[model samples]
Each structure stands twice: as C-alpha cells, then as structure tokens.
Target: MSRHDYFSQFLHAVWHGESGHPLVASLLAQPAFAVYRNTIFKGCVDALSANYPAVRRLVGEQWFQGAALAYARRHMPDDACLIAYGDGFPDFLDSVDAVRELPYLPGVARLDRYWSESHLAADDAPLDTAGLHAVLASGRDVQLAPQAATRWHWEPAYPGYSIWNANRDPGAGPLSGLEWHGEGALLTRPEGQVQWQPIGLGACRFLDACRAGMGVAAAAGLAQAAEPGLDVAVMLGELVQAGAFTSFH
Candidate 1:
C-alpha cells in the first residue's frame, strides 16, 4: 500500500480500536506508540469537554468523560480546529445507554454547538431599529438577511432551550420551577459577545423565513400563518432589537 494509504489505515485502526491492521500492527506493539495513542485520546476528550461544557456540567466530570471517550473512539476529528469538533456529539448522546432516560441531553448539546458556531462566525454589523424603519419606508419587497452569526433552533417536543440556558452559565443558580413545554432559542453575535434568548414558535418561523430568502411581506405572512394570533409588526420590532437582521435589499 502507498504511504498515504498506510497512514489512513493507521488512523482508522487507532480510532476504531482495530489494531490488528497489518500495516500498523508492529507499530501498535511499541510502548511509545501506546503513549502517543493515549495522548490523542486525551486531546479528543479535552476538546469535547470544552466544546460541550453544558453537557459536562449536567452529567458531572466522571460521567461526561466516560461518554466523551466512547464518542471519541467512534468518531475522530476531521480537521485541526478542535474548537469546531463534536458536531455529531448531540446525536451520539442519543445512542448512549446511560443518557437514554435523559432525552433533553441531546438538545442541550445542540444548543452548545450553536453557541460555538455563532462564536466563530464572521463578524458583521447587525440591523438596528433605525435601519429596519428605513428599509420599511423604502418598500416591502426587500429581503432581510440574517446575520452571519445568527443561529436559531426550535424543539417542538421538549423544553431544551430552557434547560440549556439554565446550564450554560457557570454562575447561574440552580434551575427550578421550569414549565415543562417545547421551546425555541435564538442566538446572535450582534457585537463582540454572543447573545441568546428564548423565543416563541412564531419568531422562530419568522427567522426561518428570512433565512430562506423570502421578502419581508412573505416572511411575515409565513410567521403569522404559523401563529394566527401573531402580531407581525411587534415581532419584527422585537427581532430588530435582538439584531436578527443584518441588511435588507
């Protein structure tokens, strides 16, 4: 096999626990190779811990590390940027035997992923109230573009956003008295800091419409259709304040 092919198989063997691969069998037997393998495993576990702090917080260090190790064994990082690693972690949580009873764990992990993505997204100035008003004055046919750092998610079956919000902040008080219901979260980086807020289904649909490249009027219609009692004007003003829009044209 070519050197590249051998390297590829070596990586597969390391990640998948298949050390019997002929090309890597002798190397895997060396003591130093065991150290290198352990280092790789530690790096993956540490990166995953950082990427999903809320998960770590919810499950405690011991439990979280065990889960992270299992996940690392099945999936290796695709690139050098460890900050963006663990994209599949949320889904992986679903199949974990220990967390099968905790259905909300995956959703919380998803919000964690969204936070990381928003933090790394390219910078852009968000649309303020004045800019939104000017756009409305010009015409209603204009399309509003969501900010590059904008990320939103809706969980129709669980209060995932609420649970995530409670656990994300290290200094926050213990979560209590939460109403058990579906929730949606909207994340944006309007300035240097990432901001998040719980939103309703109407607002989530509105943002979805905007992301789909719909014009202002069409997006409003869709939002209102999803929520018959929705006040489009009020919702637009709230989103404008939240820096959901970047520009309109």
Candidate 2:
C-alpha cells in the first residue's frame, strides 16, 4: 500500500477506535502517538461535556463520560467537524428508548447545543439605538440582521433553562421537579454575554418576521396582528433590553 494511504488509515483508526489492522502496533509503540490519542480523546470529551453539562449533572459524571466516550469514539463526523460537534447527539438520545423517561433530556441537550453554537458563533456588533434621533430616523423600515444579538427564547418547558443555569452558577436555584408543558425560547447575545428570556406567541411572530428579513414596520404589524392587544412599545423595549436589535438607525 502507498505510505500516505497507510498512514491515513492508521490515524483514522486510532482516533475512531476502529480496528487498526497491523498499524496498531506502530501507533502504540510511539509515545507521541499514545499521548496524541489521549489528548484528542480528552479534548473531544471536554467539548461534548461543555455542550451537555446539564446532561452530565443529571446522569452523574461517571455515567455521562462513559456514554459520551463510547459515542464520540465510535461516530465519524459528518463534515468538517472542528467548528461543531454534538450534531448527532439529539438524534442519538432520541433513539435510546431507555432514556425516553427523561423526555426533557434531549430538549435540554438541544438547548445546550444551541448555547454552545451561539457562544462560538462569529462575533458581531449588535445594532443599538443609543440616541432618540436614531430611533426616529429608523422610522419603520429597519430590520435586524440575522447575526443580531438577542436574548434566548423562552417557552413553557423552559424550567430546563433555570435548571441548566442553576448548575452553571453556585447555589443558583432548585434543579429538580422543574418540568413544565411546551417550551420555546430565544437566546441572543447583543453584547459579549448571552441573555435569555421568554417570548409571547405574538412576539415570536414578530421576531420571526425580523429573523426572516422583514422590515421593522412590517414586523411590528405582524406582532400586533398576532395579538391585537400587543404593546408594541413594551415588546420593543423588551427586545432591545434583551439585546435583540442591532443598528436601530
């Protein structure tokens, strides 16, 4: 076999935990290779761990690591996997019927995955209306960019956020018995820090319009239409305060 092909196969097997054929002996003999494998494995676990701390906390570190390790070592990434991981975890969890009892587990994992992606997402300056003139000038045609920073979306089943947030901070809140009905939340980072909040159905529609590239005036109407009694001023303030809009001018 070609040397390049043989080496590539050997490395893939080492990282993926598949049978290495004859190259396993060479890989084990080299101290650097052993260290490299350990480092890569630990790094993967650490990244996965950060993305699913609540899952780890819920299932305990030992069991979580054991399961995570088994999965991480086995699965081949879909594409260029460096920028993102855990893409399959939600599906993986869903398939594990045994864990179906923890229905919220997959959802929580999904949120955690979202948080990680948002955190690592490309940084950008969120638009802001610091002056009254900019607000007036914006008139009604303004629209938020897809990259606009904003607080997290919140839904009825959002006790999971509280539960997840609690574990991140010290002695924050109760972790158990926080389950609720349906949940829909939005998390945006207007600044460097991430903020989360619950959104009403109408508000969701409004944001969806903006997210879909609708203009402010049009989005405003959409929100108001969704809920006739919607307080536009209040909703705007909440979105602004939560760091939703960017470049109001």
Candidate 3:
C-alpha cells in the first residue's frame, strides 16, 4: 500500500479501537501503541469536556468523563479544530440510557453548543437604534439579518435555559425552586464577549422569522400571531438593544 494509505489505515485502527487491520496489526500489539491510543482518546474526551462545560458541570466530572469517552469512541472529530467538535453531542445525549431521566440534558447541551458557536463567530457590528430607524424610514421592504454571533433557542417543554444558565459557571450555587416551564435563550456577541439572556416565545418567533428572511413587519406579525397581546414594538426594541440584528436589506 502507498505510505499515505498505510498511515490512514493505522490511524483508523488506532482511533476506532480496532486491531484487525493488517497494516496496523503489529503496531496495535505494542504497549507503546496502546498508550498512544489512550492518549488520543483522552484528548478527544478533553476536547468534549471543554466544549460542553455546562454539561460537565451539571453532571459530575466522573460521569461526564465516562459519557465523553463513550461519545468520543463513536464520534471522532471531523477536523483538526477541536473547538468546533461535538456538534452531535446533544443528540448523542438523547440516546444515552443514563440520560433518559434527564430529558432536558439535550437542550442544555444545545445551549452550550450555541455558546461555543457564538464565541467562535466572525466579528460584525450589530444594528443600533439609529440604523433601525433609518431602515424604517426608508419605507422599503427589507429582511433583517441576525448578527453573525446571534444564536437563539426555544424549548417548548423544558426549562433548559434556566438549568443551563444556573450551571454555566463552576462556582454557581445550587439550583432551587425552579419553575418547570418552557424557556428560551438568546445569545449574542455584541462586543467581544458573549452575552445571553432568557427570552420569551414571542421574541423567539420574531427571531425565527428574521432568520427566515422575512421583512420586519412580517416578522412582527408572526411574533404577534405566536403570542397574542405581545408588544411587537417593545420586543423589537429590546432585540435591537440586545444587538441581535446585524443589517437589513
């Protein structure tokens, strides 16, 4: 086999815990190769731990590491950038037997993923009140684009945002007296740091409409339709202030 093909086979064998490959059979039998394989697994577990700190904090280190190892075995990083890894972690959590009792775990994982994505998103200036007014004054049909770092999620059944926000920090105190209800989370990187807040269903729908390339008026109407008596103007103002929009066209 070519050198490149040989190396690929070796890597596949080592990474997937397989020793049957003829090219890697001797290497897999070596003690040093076992150490190297373990190191690779550890690195993947570490990357997953860093990517899903909230999940790690929610579950203890021992449990999280075990889950991470299992997840790493089934799913390898697609690219060299480990920071962008674990995109399917939330879905993996959903299928885990241990996670069956914690239905909200997947949602929390998704929020953590969103936070990582926001942190890695490209820099862009968010729309300010003046820019919003200018767009309104133009009296032309335009669809507002969410900022590059803007990410929002709404869970219709679980208070995942509340759980995630409470456990996001290692030093955060124990959660108590939390009301079990649907919650929405909105994240934005207005400046350099990522910021997040609990949002309402109306706000979530509005952002969804904006993401779907609907005009401002149409987005507002969708929000109102989702939630009657919702103050679309107020919601719009709050979103603008939160730096959720990047531009309109």
Candidate 4:
C-alpha cells in the first residue's frame, strides 16, 4: 500500500480501537481528540442506551459501556466518512451468547434503534380521532402508515417497552409490574416526537389488523369480532386520543 493509504488505514484503526498501535494511548491524551472520540462513542452508547436503559440499569453503566465498547470495536464499520454508527449493535446484542437469557434485551434495542430512525423520519401530522369519526362517518377505508407497528404479546415477559418508558435515569426502577404482559402499541413520530402509546385490547386488536396490511374497515371488523362487546365509537376515540391517524394520500 502507498504510504498515505497505510497511514489512513492506521488512523481509522486507532479511532475505532481496532489497533494496538502504541501511539494510540498518547493520541488519546490529546484532550481535544479524546473528547471527539468520546463524543463519537458516547453518541453510540446514548442512542443504544436510550433504547436499552433497562439493560443498562440492570447491568450497570460500566458493564453496558464495556459491552458497547466491545460491540463498537468489532463493528468499526466500513464507512469512515460516515457521521454515525451502531446500526448493527442491536443484532450484535442478540447474537452474543452471554446475553441469551435477556430475551427482551434485543427487543429493547430494536425499539430504540427504530425510535432513532423515527426521530429522523419525514415530518407527519398524525391522525386525530376527531377527524377519524368523521372518516368513519364518511365510510372510507383507512390504513396505517408503513412506518407504523403494533402487536399484542400473549407472553408478558417483554418489559422492553416499559423499560423504555422509564426515564433515562434508573431512579424510577423497572416500570411497575415489570413482568411482561399483553401489550398493544402504536409507534410513530407524528409532530416530531416519538410517541409510544400503550393500547388496550380493543385498540390492540384493531391496530394489529391494520398492521397486517388490512384495510381500516376490515381491521375494525376483526377487532369487533374478537371483542364482540367493543364499543366501536369509544375504542375509536381511544385510538384517536393516542394520535392514531395521519394525512392521507
């Protein structure tokens, strides 16, 4: 390799901890560069931590950082000209054998990672049920956005969502009733905030129907089918209150 190319490779390695170069420690001593590197890693950790605060709290900051460091080290990423990384950390967490018992750990990471993307998504005005009632009044079939996701886990062990709900600081401790249970949710970045609204049985079934690529009318019918006594109007109200709708094509 040309001298310039070799130097560039070495620099990249040093930046990501891939190299055992003796100069690395000394270079890290330069307060400015160290701060820059720390910022880079901190950004990675913060994004991942925001999603995995429960894991971090459960494992402690030092342990979490150690994992993040090890993860960032292996996945140095080929795009050096890139602005950020850690896109692969979630899967990395899943692949590691040590954390196998943390079944919901990967899920938390996935949620956080998606939230990051949502934060960067195109701005959208979420659908409000006020208009939704009018839509139903108009009898038009509605559909959720491609960006939306929802589910009801019969097994409640995935407290991933609740952990995320708890503040970044672990002071609140695990969310009350920390054990997993049936949960319905709608995730969207309507109005520039990543909203994670927990849904009830009626709304959960309805949203799941919609998420399965079902039309609004069909999904609503399925929801009513499962919950025969569902108050369609009231359920729709609850959905609307949770920012259910967005602009139509």
| Candidate No. with top lDDT | 3
Q: Cα lDDT of all candidates, in order? A: 0.86, 0.67, 0.88, 0.61
Per-residue lDDT of 163 in model 3: 93
Give the residue spans of candidate 4 off by over 4 A.
Answer: 1-52, 77-84, 126-131, 146-157, 167-180, 189-191, 200-213, 221-233
Clashing pairs in 4: 126-245, 127-245, 127-246, 156-180, 156-181
- Number of clashing residue pairs in every model? 0, 18, 0, 5
Ranking by lDDT: 3, 1, 2, 4
lDDT of 1 by residue, 26-68 (tens): 7877788778888898999999999999989989999999999
Superior candidate under TM-score, 3 versus 4: 3
Give, for candidate 3, the lowest lDDT window spanning 10 residues: 14-23
Among these predicted structures, which one has the highest TM-score?
3
- TM per candidate comes to 0.93, 0.74, 0.94, 0.65
Candidate 4 residue lDDT tens string, 156-206? 456555665564335556556565554444566545566665555666677
TM-score result, candidate 2: 0.74
Model 4 TM-score on a 0 to 1 scale: 0.65
lDDT of 3 by residue, 19-115 (tens): 5667588788789998998988898899999999889988899999999999888887788779888999999999999998888999999999999
Model 2 residue 100 distance off true place after TM-score fit, in angstroms: 0.6
Q: Candidate 2 or 3, higher lDDT?
A: 3
